[model samples]
Target chain A: MGAEVKQTILNRLIGGIDAMSPRLRLAAKYIVDNQSAFGIDPIRTSADKAGVSANTFVRLADRLGFDGFDDLREPFRVSLLERYDGSAGEAWLDDLSHAGAFAADHARTLRNEMDIVKQSLRLLTPHKAEAAAALLTEARNAYVTATRSSYALAYYFHYVARMSLPHVHLIPRHMGSPVDEMVSVEPSDVLMAITFPPYSADTIDALRLARRSGMKVILLSDSELIAPAIQADLFLKVSVQSHHSFSCYAGAMAVLDSLLHHIVTRGGKAAELRISRYQSLREDFGAYWRAKLPRLRRE
Target chain B: MGAEVKQTILNRLIGGIDAMSPRLRLAAKYIVDNQSAFGIDPIRTSADKAGVSANTFVRLADRLGFDGFDDLREPFRVSLLERYDGSAGEAWLDDLSHAGAFAADHARTLRNEMDIVKQSLRLLTPHKAEAAAALLTEARNAYVTATRSSYALAYYFHYVARMSLPHVHLIPRHMGSPVDEMVSVEPSDVLMAITFPPYSADTIDALRLARRSGMKVILLSDSELIAPAIQADLFLKVSVQSHHSFSCYAGAMAVLDSLLHHIVTRGGKAAELRISRYQSLREDFGAYWRAKLPRLRRE
Candidate 1:
């Protein structure tokens, strides 16, 4: 399939959404709403969930000028293969519907996270980590950006990083537009963007603005094939696949922690002094509560 | 050992902190600063990191009226045993310090997280999960409280829960004191408290206040031996031990996810409508980015 053909199909789907029959509209809505799932789910299952017949799915595809439903699904499948590692976790979700299957689901989710962590470690070579750490250490200022599902990871990273490094900012400045925050980014600074599919557009827009300003961009995403990869100065992939509707972030958190650790350990006396100061201040502010141990007899 | 002796030792340590010699002060500071490590690390290693002689630790213990360093460390060890599962990850840290050991460390951390997840699954019985879900579903209002490292988990939980259910509040209003927020909580409400050691004093205080208000208290903690556990109307323990300095949250996140899933799936039509409404609003707001697939030839 050529780019033109894919674009044509997508345009037709978008343009013709209003004119389709109710059944075709249901199928179309499912396709548009769950593009990722459409890529991986079987046609029959997709039809069943969308409450449409498989024949309707085929008819819709034919209406859209595809040879068959497979043609319609081909772009999605290819995208999935290029952009994600491992299966789509539909089977894991199936297990979750069974009675007393929560334990099994939990186990599978953890196992999946472990596998992702291992894969991330394998993919993030020491050389690349060292390079990324050096960029963070050398940058005059750094900004971190993530949105939606990834916001927690960004918040944690920024909270921890700001403790040991000066001038580390989490964009788009709480109350201001993210674009406004990206406006001041300079070549001497770095923007560490954390995003995964469905990737946050705000983060991508920030990345674009930062890149245009000549700021170094460090992209932490689920796959290198993501659109933002082309703009990144350094790209690190960490898997976030989960059995549930939301993406798992355990692997992403681990990667971010490892990156922060690398920067701190690789940084010399300056880093040590900063961390020690942060620790002292934390203690003084009573950020950590002392455990009130119940008295026990000495042996 | 009886409780009185342990209290005596701890009291002595706190009382004598101001008058100790410089070397003893160093050991004392290490003990105070890293109580968890003091509980788990060997004297030699702890002293080495504290930049003091092992003799200083013994001397400090003696000054505190202990038989030796072992007596000084005993309470911490006991507390560790009662409150946490698995080793304190000394070996994992050792592996981290070695050159080219990042992969090994990553694998170990993931493995440890997997074990914790499994242990948590075993501990959190289906009956308890169902009961917790029912409480959440039936509550007139629900509030979540957590502090410091555990704050992210609380935020995620509250964020997701509020989407599917009404009247879910994250405790300790962002800009105001947590006490201010707790004032509005009524007996009919539910307070879900997430905490781990060293336990946050603020969260514990909130829990106490909520209990006094006659609200149902649901405690999610690393261990049932924690002080707040006694006051809890419902207690759920999930291990957060990891191979790194910070606690692994994969297990905690899993438990929270499971709880939410239970509430949603069992909530019937009201829940389904809420979720569907949420999904539609998310799309309307462009909360999810569309996938930009590059065209690929059909095989």
Candidate 2:
């Protein structure tokens, strides 16, 4: 029943997109694009994401024949509830219990993961990556921000980038106040924000703060239709879809890896020297284990 | 030249495997199985990994007609040196420079990741996953630890497990001292250690300390030939190979996901209730974004 209502809402939004005002058009487009997220997220959150005011959301809902915003959101909530009501858990167990079931499931997962990576690659063009890299290269400082599951990508990017460039930082360091961390982000800085569905409020807030501060914002997300993408100077979409409840991150990791490689390679000899120096320092610090065996027999 | 020498060593080990005594056979088996890693790691590390004393490593070298362990390790070191001389970097750049290169590279990475996941699935059978899940279900406390690149897997595992189980802990919390964190891990507790090649010394040290405290260790790694694997009550191998410099972690993540799903489903209603409680609490805390729009038009 809820799924039917969602389908109707989706059909109405898609059909009505042309007749809406510019702001309503943007809201309609976002709703059309992120129907899944729209179903679950709050109006204020979705409004903030779509780069429109909450008033705009209410007007759009009225235009769509809904009694109120809550009515519009009900279908999404109902669908999510149905999804979380244990069917996935049962299917997960059934897949694991039988012979060849595990193998078949694994094969399907691999295929889904591959499809995600392909989609991400198609979305994240090299031209856009190069442009983003140029911004990072030219910026006085570079800051990376991501929350929850997406934080790993931010951390990995910061860790590897800082090895070759000295000005890279991971925001909200040591669980400090994010506002405090963003205070120093100047207009000359580049702020890279990564967030996907169940989009993090903290990350969205950070991106807003960065934009207000005049920093060049590079947004890596699952889609350009997302609200954070609206504020981005450069928006790179990377798919994170998966067969399981949690999203797969391989595509994100690969995209970041490629971006870093471009940055380093473009930086030329200076980057190479810095990386070598870092490697040598790591060796000097005894950071890696030595493989020496005993010499008793030789003696 | 280095490749030839490494190949000769591999052939010799294979030819001599059946003729050796049981202990020597074990050493030979490890040496042959981990030929790639053997070429890079120190002999003592390899010997320790094979569950033999350093003296056995020296004796094996003697039996192989090497002057000492150093001589036996020379080919592997030389091969590693040749590899590190920079062909991979050149190939990486070339792949990124052309049109459709990004798409092609992504496809290859997806294929490689799929292979890794398949290999890991093959290694980690249903029976083995059930045994590990049973241990996790029965444990009084479950602590998860992984560092550097592999840390994401540990974080994801801990995050999801904690949603359904109260006793789950992330080791070395907030990047604090691992030793201090493990001080209270009792015999009834379970320690899950995840590490991969160019493995972190800190994780290995933590695993050793946990073993000394009589905690059961579940080790997740790229290969069973690693030193920590020897001490693992449960050693699960998940490949992390990639065309790029850094390893792909999707395989490890998939394996951990499957393991956790098994645990949750096997734990039945208790796990479901806990998860629901977590979801409800998240909603209550306003941890998620709400979609409420302003009442401007309605008023």
Instruction: Please tell me the TM-score of chain B in candidate 1 relative to the true structure's chain B.
Output: 0.62
Give me the runs in candidate 1 sitting further than 4 Å from their true place: A1-128, A225-230, A267-299, B1-125, B223-230, B242-246, B268-273, B284-299
* Candidate 1 C-alpha lDDT tens digits along A147-245: 765766777777667766777888765655567776666899999988876555677678778878889989999865555335689998887665544
Candidate 2 docking classification: incorrect
Whole-model Cα lDDT per candidate?
Answer: 0.66, 0.67
The recovered share of true contacts, given per candidate in order, is 0.04, 0.05
- In model 2, the clashing pairs are A42-B290, A42-B291, A43-B291, A43-B292, A49-A227, A291-B42, A291-B43, B39-B76
Q: Write the per-residue lDDT of candidate 1 for residues B1-299, one digit (tens) a residue.
A: 22223445666777788898888888887876665567656789899989998888989888877888888887765534333222233344334435566544444444455446545554566667878987887899998888766776787788767777778888765655566787677899999999875566677777778878999989898744343223578889776764333456656766776677667666667876886676556544434334344422123
| Residue A118 displacement (Å), model 1 | 5.1
**Separate DockQ for every predicted complex:** 0.03, 0.03
Model 2 Cα lDDT, one tens digit per residue, B1-299: 34445667878999888899998988888877765456544667787899987788889999999999878877765544332211122243335434486544443443454445544554566667877887787889988897765776787778777766678888777766567788777999998888875566678778888888899889898643344123578878776765544566656765776676666766678887886675455434323333352212111
Q: How many backbone clashes does candidate 1 have?
A: 7
Q: Compare the candidates by lDDT and give the number of the best one.
A: 2
State the TM-score, rounded to 2 decimals, of chain A in model 2.
0.61
